[model samples]
Target chain A: EAEVAQSPRYKITEKSQAVAFWCDPISGHATLYWYRQILGQGPELLVQFQDESVVDDSQLPKDRFSAERLKGVDSTLKIQPAELGDSAMYLCASSSNQQGPYGYTFGSGTRLTVV
Target chain B: AQRVTQPEKLLSVFKGAPVELKCNYSYSGSPELFWYVQYSRQRLQLLLRHISRESIKGFTADLNKGETSFHLKKPFAQEEDSAMYYCALSSFGNTPLVFGKGTRLSVIA
Candidate 1:
């Protein structure tokens, strides 16, 4: 039962400050994803990565948000000049296959709050 | 665009009662459907997928292609079954999942 690990379970940052969240996917997982879950809403995809290359980031706010999997084993998501509306639960997930009946494994998520 | 729709925002049922969480989708081609559950103080995890066709924790969902629906159901609900359930859809290949607004199930004793 390997689990995805996330750092900084809870974070509070001032508006205009930078915030970053880290995620370490399960060993041998090739695909990783970053999602944002707003209160009372389902999680939305921010970015998807296969190994170190990005597969899809159409929904990601390129101006303020960026995600990278430098080594492909772990990944980081950063928001520059965080805004109040950016407060949400950032989730990370990993899977061995791109699409299959065996779904991805998700992390506990990092709760972000901007003041 | 692939989309998943979970109609009810919240569903409350008594323990030992049958439970059903409705879900519908809109996809042009064949898509994969999944049910993810998040318990209190726990991470989101996969409950079951339509492709598997296997019941988990007494829960099962049948994919109805004509109606474009994949609803999650259980014969008898338990208190521990209370959680937030999300319906997700994904196309073939390395596509990101599109999730619905989820339904909160409260199995009251």
Candidate 2:
């Protein structure tokens, strides 16, 4: 089975430090998403990308967080000056297209902890 | 706003017992509903979608438009079925999915 790849399974960073997470979606997937999951809450979308162009980033915190998919294939999410509240699991998912019954495929996720 | 709601945060069932995880949604337009499951130390994966109307691992979900619900159900639960299940909704088009808080199902022997 083709799986989404994510780097740095766990990360611990001090406040005011920068942290980044990487994700490589399955081949042929066109829509990629970045989501943040708090300890007790469901995952929330941070950004969505259609190929290399961003489709929606309304929930993303622009001041401190940034995400990009340079080649429309792999993506990277970065947080500057990480805050304690930023501790959570960052998940990456991808789908072949906007249509179809095949739901998104998610990566194992990168667990972030800011102290 | 589109939203998915899973009323129960945790549910427990004995092996061989029937299981149902409730899910409701608030969407004005035609919506797509899905159930995603995450096992221990595993990535979240799609268990089933309302569009498919197919049973997977003995699990099934029926989309009730009038009730605005798409609840996951299984005839008999197994110990391996214990996992965190999330109900998600997506509006028409290429919109992103909105997920509920999720329910932790524990099937004990």
Candidate 3:
């Protein structure tokens, strides 16, 4: 089975530090998403990208968070000056344009902890 | 705005017992409903979708337009079914999914 790849399974950073997470979606997937899952809460969409163009980022904290899919294949999410409240699991998902019955395929996620 | 609601935060059931995870949504237009499951130390994956109308792993969900609900149900629960289940909604366009708080289902032997 083709799986989305994420780097740095776990990351711990001090407040005011910068952190970045990488995700490589399945081959040929056009839609990619970045979501944040807080403990005891469901995942929340942070940004959505179709190819290299962003489709929706209304929920993303533009001041501190930014996501990009430079090549329209792999994506990277970065948070500058991470805050304690930023601790959560960052998940990446992908889906082809067809997007049959089943929804997007998710990555294992990168757990971030800011102290 | 599209939103999904899963009232129960946690549910416990014994193996071989029937189980149902409630889910409701608020959407103006026709929305796509999905149930995603996350097992211990595993990635979140799609379990079923209302559009498919196919039972997977003995679990099925029916979309009720009048009540605006899409609840997941299973005839007989199994220990392996213990996991966190999330209900999600998506609109017609290429929009991001909106997920509910989720329910932790614990199927004990």
Q: Where does model 1 exceed 4 Å of error?
A: A98-101
* Interface RMSD, in order shown: 1.8, 1.8, 2.0
User: What is the per-residue lDDT of model 3 for residues A1-115, given as tens digits with 9 covering 90 to 100?
Assistant: 9999998999999999999999999999999999999999999999999999998899999999999999999999999989999999999999988883255999999999999
State the C-alpha lDDT per candidate.
Answer: 0.93, 0.94, 0.94
What CAPRI-style quality would you assign to candidate 3?
Answer: medium
lDDT of 3 at A38: 98
Tens-place lDDT digits, model 2, residues A3-115: 99998999999999999999999999999999999998899999999999999999999999999999999999999989999999999999987453365889999999999
lDDT of 3 at A53: 95
Q: In model 1, state the lDDT of residue A74.
A: 99
In Å, residue B106's CA in model 1 sits off its true spot by: 0.3
Clash pairs (backbone) in predicted model 2: none
Clashes of each: 0, 0, 0
lDDT of 1 by residue, A24-114 (tens): 9999999999999999999999999999999899999999999999998999999998999999999999988744426588999999999
Best of the two (1, 2) by DockQ: 1
Q: State model 1's lDDT.
A: 0.93
Among these predictions, the greatest DockQ belongs to 1
Q: What DockQ would you assign to candidate 3?
A: 0.65
